[model samples]
Target: MASRRTTRRLAADAGLLVVAAAFVLPLAWVILSALDPHANLRVKTPDGLTLDNFDAILTPEITFTPLLNSLILCGGATLLTVVCAALAAYPLSRFRSRFNRPFLLTILFATSLPITAIMVPVYALFVQVDLIDTMQGTIFFFAASQLPFAIWLMKNFMDGVPKELEEAAWTDGASAFQSLLRIVLPLMGPGVSVVTVFSFVMMWGNFFVPFMLLLTPDQMPASVSINDFFGNRGMVAYGQLAAFSIVYSTPVILLYVLIARRLGGGFALGGAVKG
Candidate 1:
């Protein structure tokens, strides 16, 4: 029995290491490709290595407009999603309404629904509203898409928090809204941070919606900018494209690393112990 258990543990660890490598290897390749001047993304041969690609993209002529566009869209969308989800989740978490479970289930269903399924309708609606190419419109669209999942995650985190904290605040003449603002929201920090990060990443990296809706070249997101770098009609500007990708992706990676530490324990259930 002991031998079997040891074998299983070894196998699990080995499997996890393999999985980790699988994920890391692609990112490593991206970094290498970005540095390799002779690396043609269109035609991948094994031997090319150089930093000219990074230098070319970082040069002032390359411009940082795409990076700025991504920041605006992601920042606006993330803020909107977190605020809306927090407002929505608080009531659902505290109330014992007959519709509460059904409402949450509906949100779960929405989260699972593929964005492709609604693309046509949403695009048409945006066109009708003359919002197809605007940053504000895109931000709202991204916020709405992320809200269901954010609310669900936050509600679950809030559920694990004790109701008595809010109740005690209420006894002190705090309004329901006040109790949520002063008591509950402060405690839901971790889960909210996770969802905010998720929403920001999604909006930042999204390509399809921006590709289809944003007609103007100037309004394009970084994903679209990268696609354009490769050129239309299958032309590959390998060096510039490689550089642009690295420049755009670096800030995203750095931001995640910075935010991850702050979000660590605040939202977890173990952090919910009475203070």
Candidate 2:
């Protein structure tokens, strides 16, 4: 029995190492290739490190404008999604109704539907409305695409807060909105962070949505503009591509760092709920 257990443990550890390597190797290639001026598809050490790759792609046309567009699009969408999700979730969390379960189930169903399945109709609608190349239009769609899952997550987190606290606030003449803003939301900081980060990251990395909606080159976000690295006939600038990728990833990293504390902090509701 002891021998069998040892063998199983060893096998599990080996499998995990293999899985880790699969992810780590690609990331390693990206980092190393970014430093190599003449990078290729193969992962190997360069003759010497150089910053030429970074220098080449740091121009306003290649990096600055698209990055600014991404920040505007993803940032606006994330803020909108979080606010809408909070408002939509509050009633579902605090009220009792037979419709809530069905509504939530519908939201869950919506989340499972792939973006590609509806893109055809969405594109046609955008064209009809003359919003095909607009930034605000893209932000609206981005928020809508992420809203379903955001509501689901927000509702689950909001449920964790005790109703007694809201009742006390009600007795003090606070409105539903006030109670939500001052009490429930403060207690559910981790959930908001999760939703904000999830929404922003999803929008930031999304290539297809913005690609289909925005036609103007000047309006394209970093997600769509990164395709410029690939040239005709399967040619690609691997070094510059890797450098752009690292720069493109900076905002999301910074967002996570900013919210790290709130995301890790669980609801401190024990004392408030005890009495």
Candidate 3:
């Protein structure tokens, strides 16, 4: 029995290491390749490390413009998704109704549907409405695509907050919206952070949505513009591409850092409600 347990533990540890390497190796390649002046698809040490890769792609046309567009597009969509999710989730969390379950189930169903499945109709609708290449149009689509899962996450998190605090606020002449803004939302900080980060990251990494919606080169976000790294002759600037990838990932990493405290801090409702 002791020998069997040891074997199982060793097997589990080996399996985990393999999985970890699968993810870590690609990241290693990206960082290594970014520094290698003559970077290629193979992962290997370069003769000399240089910043030429970074310098080449730092121009306004390549890096700054698309990054700015991504910030605008993803940032706007994330804000909209969080606000709408909060509003939609509050009622489902606080109220008792038969319809809530069905509605939530519908949202869950919506989340499972692939974006590709509906892109044809969505593209046609955008063309019909003369919003095919507009920033606002893309922002709206980004918000809608993320809203379903955002609401599900928000509602689950909101459920953890106690209702007694809201009742106390109500006695003090606070409206439903006021109680939500001042009491419930403040208490569910972690939930809001999760939803915000999830929505922004999803929209930021998305290549297909913005690609299909926005046609104008000037309006393309970093997610879409990154495709330019691949030349017409199947030649890719691997070094520059790796550099851009690292820069592309910085905002999401910074967002997580900013909200790290809130995400780890569980609801401190210990003394708020007394029997």
Candidate 4:
């Protein structure tokens, strides 16, 4: 029995390694292609490694402008989503009104609605308001779209923060808003971090929204700008595209590395409840 269990454990580990490699192999190919000067659709070891692919693509007009545009749009949208979600979540989490349940259900339903379904109306409204090709308008739409899911997550996180802490704060003459700022929010850091990262990632990877809304090339984000690497009539710069992708993806990778562990370390609600 002992020997059989040992064999099964080894088999499981081997199976897991295969699963891991399946995902890692593609990422490995992209990195290798980025370094290969003559990289094509087929990824292979560099015939002669060179930084020229990166150099050719890195320019203020082509790369930096779109990169900066992405950062601004994503950053602004994330900030808006996190703040609004937190405030909205706090009430939903703490209040016990009959309307709260139905309201939250509505939000959950909204989360499943595809953005494409609403784009026609959204674009028409943008036209009426003269917001076409505008960064602020894009950012606003991004935040608004992400708000339903962010609020749902925030509310669950806020719920994990015990009401006992707020009760103590109330005893000390602290207002509800004051308690939220000092006690509740501080304890829900992991939750907020998750929401912030999620919002940022969604906006950063978005292509269709910016592609449709932004008419001026100068206003395009990196997600939309990368399309230029695919030229008209059967031409594509694979090496340059790979290199640009690496640059485009670094911020999100760094952000996940920084906060990923905390994202799983949700509030120890039991301790707060006991306190």
For residues 1-275, write the lDDT of model 1, one tens digit per residue. 99999999999999999999888876666666776666665435436667766666664335477777888888998999999998999889898899998998899888878986787888899999999989888888889888888888888878878999888888899998898888888887666776777678778878887777777888777888777665663767566675677778777677577555665633432342111
Off by over 4 Å in 2: 1-8, 232-235, 253-275
The list of candidate 3 runs beyond 4 A from truth reads 1-11, 232-235, 254-275
Instruction: State the displacement of the C-alpha of residue 73, model 2, in Å, after optimal TM-score superposition.
Output: 0.6
lDDT of 3 at 11: 100
Give the alpha carbon lDDT tens digit for every residue of 13-98 in model 2: 99999999887988888899999978998789975899999999999999999999999999999999999999999999999999
Q: 1-275 in candidate 4: lDDT tens per residue? A: 99999999999999999999888987987798899988877657888889988898898977899999999999999999999999999989998999899999999888878997788888889999999899999989999999998898889889999999899999999998999999999998887887788789878998888887788988889999888887542578788889999999998888766665554532432322222
Winner of 2 and 4 under lDDT: 2
Q: Lowest-lDDT window of 10 residues in candidate 2?
A: 266-275
Superposed on all Cα atoms, the candidates' RMSDs to the truth, in angstroms, are 4.7, 5.0, 5.1, 4.2
119 in model 2: Cα distance from truth in Å?
Answer: 0.7
What lDDT score belongs to each candidate, Candidate 1 first? 0.77, 0.88, 0.88, 0.86
Number of clashes found in candidate 2: 0
Between candidates 1 and 4, the lDDT winner: 4
Writing each residue's lDDT as its tens digit, candidate 3 over 1-275 gives: 99999999999999999999887888899999999999998789875999999999999999999999999999999999999999999999999999998998899889878988898899999999998999999999999999998898888889999999999999999999999999999998876887888789889989999989999889999988888888442779899999999999988877766656554533222211110
lDDT for 270 in candidate 1 is: 32
Clashing pairs in 4: none
